[model samples]
Target: MFPKPIEKSSRSTQLTYQALLPVALLLWLAPLIAVALFAIRPSVDFTVGNYWGMPSSFEFFENFAQVFNSSMPRYILNSFMITIPTVIGAVALSAMAGFALGVYKFKANLLLFFMFIAGNFVPFQILMVPVRDLTLDMGLYNTKTGLILFHVAFQTGFCTLFMRNFIKALPFELIEAARVEGIREWQIFWYVVLPLMKPALAALSVLIFTFIWNDYFWAIVLTQGENAQPVTAGITSFNAQFRAMYHLMSAGSLVAALPPVAMFFLMQKHFIAGLTLGAVK
Candidate 1:
């Protein structure tokens, strides 16, 4: 039912795969390569239609420096403010909810879990209008708090799914033993289950951080300007009234991408472990 492993493939097949890998890699990275090249080029290069050609002059430091010299710093701080709170709130709530749903055997357990899963399948575009209206009604439209709250609510469903499954895979005997030893339910959860959940928590934190950090749609829709807008939306400020600063935008894009990339690298081991923890029998 599955294709043979590359190691088990015929010698010719292996050789062909190796030959095409670099080409495929380059093709996949073409847009990124183009953006990087554009980020280093002078505005005159783009003005003279020298795109995809040699840069007339390298302005790497100038382009990157201009990005930081703008209101990009405020936007980045806004991202951290919004994303960190959303991550903590969503993960915390989901962990508790997942523990309850996974540990308890309530009559409506499956129904409730299904409800959380259902929200994830719904197209978020449809909610944009109502969400915007709701935010406006609550006077939170264009505020970091509103963005953080919305992200936490929106992401909780998926986070619960991830946490519930991970918690479910945990040993039931530990809970039973804890109970027999007169450990209170909260204590069992806080002291016993919580420690074991570190890997899953770390993984989910990294995932959610990346999601909220890279979020452009809701960032633009829910917030505006450098005061509340995340770096993703704030990058658009590079567009001037008369002309677009493509080089500055490209540099800003690269800078905006760093936190999530750094986060993933830092938590790479835990992320992989959390994902693969319950996979094996």
Candidate 2:
């Protein structure tokens, strides 16, 4: 909807558009398609002489076996360790902050809300030094906890903006009726607001999971090795070891990409709902 749809053009123009679609898609997916194809290609067949020829033998099992038996398992575990805690902490903090800003009419409400909104847009480098120092000072440097804390704090800025707007759009009458029933502030939040936040929670879970899972910068800055490094950093090390092993690298990339992909597939509905919540008037 960002760009207005084009009306039916001339037959020649339509033909041109149809012709370009496949070319565009192929261009976009060329790298992935090449990787997928290479994953099944025998190393002999993948020689420069036959890179695109019909694979002489499918080696997907062999490549996947190597990847599985390699550092991928530890990386997967690390990614989950970092992603899950960050998602929970960011969502939980944002939910509470969003409730206060959405429900209260304090003079600083908008100011605080905009502060979070603006924070999300700032360059991450500005906070890197301070955040890393804080993590080190806490003795969480080079640990999963360090990565989780930074992710939670950084992601909370965006999540708070999202949840605040989402909560604001809910009917005020619901809170009013609950108030009339003599519900305390915490009870109103727990019973009336939190229950209705299911869709928002699901949506954010998928989004944050993918973001944290794919994170590279903070992972490198905070974590050192397989002990605490997530898949992105793990992949960097993998790439170094397997410099000439394209098939293994491809398989590793696919494995690294699978979790977020699965999460999106599983929570597609909630994700879409959260994203589109404010699209309509």
Candidate 3:
């Protein structure tokens, strides 16, 4: 059974919830607050192990400027290059594949759908060595294309699961109507199904963009340097040989996090609708 809404709670329960809300909120935001404070602190504070303490001097602008002045901009661009292509490639392929699995009737359809779902359950760590060697053999190691391809492939299974369910929830009568009116299957999908899938597509795009952008493990495993490394891994560029630039790394981290945050906010409406499409009725 679900917990009742706060509005339905007794007066004492309401008071207790209200009293604890701010504390819970602060606890959730504690790490983010620490990171922000770290970004504004001068380098000396970190050198002297003054973490969790107030900054001796605020150097917010200077720290962020240093990050931009370094190869951070290149890494940001690389993130966009890799993230955008992967999102597009994964979503597009999944759309077609989902249509087939969700719309058509075939003996192997359920098996293929299960296979895609199974891929999601496989531990990614197991594929690390083989995936790296595969890129090397294909002459794509340390290349953005390689990273993009790998992300697309890895993401497709989850995306297919998302899209196929969304497609299945759509009224099958629409497809029948289109067929009766003499529209080709491709035309029906492109004009009818794709248009109706905007909410789902927007939702999936934001999700995939966030996942690919925040990926540091694959970034380090599959690519190297500013040419191919995304901002997530490139944040390590702040580390020097003798010491770590914690302040600069903090600034870089905040900068790297902005795009995905902005993406979610901008597409918030469609994302919510897409997710809740079949939850009701």
**Which candidate number maximizes TM-score?**
2
Residue runs of model 2 more than 4 Å from their true location after superposition: 1-24, 274-281
**lDDT score, residue 128, model 1?**
95
TM-score of each model, in listed order: 0.89, 0.90, 0.89
In candidate 1, the residue pairs with backbone N, CA or C atoms under 3 Å apart (3 or more residues apart, or in different chains) clash, namely: none
Tens-digit lDDT track of model 2 for 77-127: 999999999999999999999999999899999999999989989997898
Worst 10-residue lDDT window, candidate 1: 272-281
Clashing pairs in 3: none
Q: What would you estimate as the lDDT of candidate 1?
A: 0.87
What is the lDDT for 37 in model 2? 81
Locate the minimum summed-lDDT window of 10 residues in model 3: 272-281
Error of 2 at 48 (Å): 5.2
Q: What is the lDDT of candidate 2?
A: 0.88
